[model samples]
Target: MSRFFQRLTFVLAATIFAALGLGFALGEFGMFGVHAGGEQDGAYRQMHVYAEVLKRIQSDYVTDPNINTVTTGALHGLLESLDADSSYLTPTEYKIYKNRPTTGVAQIGLIVSKRYGYATIVSVIPGSPADREHLADGDVIESIGDTSTRELSLAVIRLMLEGKTGSTLSLSVVRPRKPDPDKITLTRTVVSPPALSEQQYENSSILYLKPGELTAARVDELAAKIKAAGKTRKILLDLRDVSEGDADQGIRVANFFINQGTLAVLEGQKFPRQTFSADPSKFLTSAPVAVLVNRGTYGAAELAADAVEDAKRGDVVGERTFGEGSVQKTIEMPDGSALLLTVAKYEGPDGKKIQDEAVAPTVIVSQNTDDDIDADNPQPKQGDEILNKALALLKAKNS
Candidate 1:
């Protein structure tokens, strides 16, 4: 009933409804892109239900319920109901977001996603705070800095991870096989993932290159490495646990292998469906290249994997990749914050949408344990299973 509460509720409701309306328009035009949709009548009915519920909580709920909490929850549900990536950004949270530097916002270095209302660690950047702590993938982040991550969106979670270097963020992580969640704190640091690295498989001509993170700089590094390894005839591009980059670099990596073909496609609401074609001139090598992938393989790495599989350029070995292929458009708001929206979804050359259909391996190499293995650091450290599998297949091809 208070004026502040009333205003907060109204803004939350209006912004969510407006976003839905915009999405609907985009969907109708094939530019409007979201995974969920409904008829106009249904939309109106839901609006009514939301309004009535909100009013009831305001007037009759016990303990003068926190209106901000209620509205925030509603907004999260509204966007999330459509898809995992959609979210509503509050003005305050947006301020903290916009203020951060574009390059190297301080971080603990863990790729994450929302699962069952909590942030689940998808992958950890090697040499990062999370990796140093042995924060295995699938570890559920219960809270960050005294706040539970259960209600936080991926965007907000990311924002929370970034801060001044040396500033520590507290985390309560529920790791697999652990009875109780463990308390962990990580100091923010400039997380610079490695560009491209190469090591020859013992006594084999096959070169294993791990392009750690597929950023623009890393792409150039990849080109140089490929040139250096000229005519090597056998390459195993390890893409497991690769991220911290954009889709463009993924295309560039694919371009190095594929010659003259549609590398991938993009579709969205608000943007015309577009195709990314690769020129024969852009092709780097046709040498028998095999890409190593696993569940840790995500984002741009998925693009690279898809291209290799689609173009028949190489064999994708190890486990299936984490299919994350969407381009986010961060729109700054009048109140000095932003709306981070998923404007488009990526598809492979064969037309399989990365968001839905993960890039499965050409040759499935299942590991004995399902312990969310880190692609950067394999267990047992000795006879590496996936790499050995790739080496055998590559050697067979040469034989």
Candidate 2:
């Protein structure tokens, strides 16, 4: 038993030293933008601090601690500190990620991201399990089944939520109105993307289009609708609850309205800056436009909202969008663990990184109009305030 303890201590020390060396090398390569020798020295000092902390933990802890578990958690924290999208996948987690099915995967229909060191719901697809359970944007998921989300990487949290059809996922959720966490069980199902909904308001003068997902096909449908509307009807794009879809498709949707100027820019330490300019040929709409957004709007939807707002092309109405726009590069470690690092981030036309600073609405309107919630009447009041506000703004605009 004493020999086992000594072996464990030696292993922990070696792991810590290895991590320190990797950190130093990354700093030397300007990964963290530390080019100065003074910064390098400071980094080395921090590494020693880490070593001291590990030594104290092994020597003074009341009970025998799992050194391997501690090391794994440290690596998870190291990657997560960079961004919500970047994650550290352990060997087992990486194996699952690599073997995850391309199609026929079941899910509860929640778009999730890490915020405040916990897994947060970005959006719940309409008619899906999560939406049916009344989960809303900004809701914090404290744990999944027996595991706390704080100890799990963002990649693992996402994987845990998906499984074979009919599989059950248990969750402890913290809602804004509820003080205590709610325990819920969800059965995973294949959630189909909501179809593009089009409606004409104000005697068909304002064309309202709501796309639940920003796929290439959806954007193509949007273009077809705009072209078919002719020169009479104005556009009111509803991007609320849009969290899924390809990022490039979202940029293409922006080009439908913006004929000129820089739409978005991608840049990183090693990645060359690439500017995405609007193509005049893709510009299908010259009519007055307004875009609706909410906390559920993320990734590609953020790109569209930011483009419109920055181009001064339309009024962006509703709450600030959920920020999420970055490209990740997967790096596999020698031990079979992997790192998903943010290689580049997308910036709005105004030079603001969408992932850092989410798109703010030009016209701010709360999704909930009710100032107080009645316990007896838990059901929300009828009518969408965000849509109404956007329509009002579009009604006042000239074609």
Each model's total of backbone clashes:
7, 0
lDDT of 1 at 314: 82
Model 2's alpha-carbon lDDT is 0.82
- Tens digits of per-residue lDDT for model 2, 240-297: 8889988889999999899999999999877899999999988888888999899989
Q: What is the lDDT of residue 246 in candidate 1?
A: 87
Which parts of model 2 are misplaced by more than 4 Å?
Answer: 1-39, 369-382
Model 1 C-alpha lDDT per residue in residues 18-116, reported as the tens digit of each score: 564443433332112234345544554555566667788878988788876787677767666655676767788777666767986788989987777
Clashing pairs in 2: none
Instruction: Give lDDT per model, in order.
Output: 0.76, 0.82
- What TM-score against the true fold does each predicted structure earn? 0.86, 0.89
Candidate 1 wrong stretches, greater than 4 Å: 1-13, 22-38, 202-204, 331-338, 367-383
Q: For candidate 2, which ten residues in a row score worst on lDDT?
A: 371-380
- Where is model 1 poorest over a 10-residue stretch in terms of lDDT? 25-34
User: For residue 163, what is the lDDT in candidate 2?
Assistant: 93
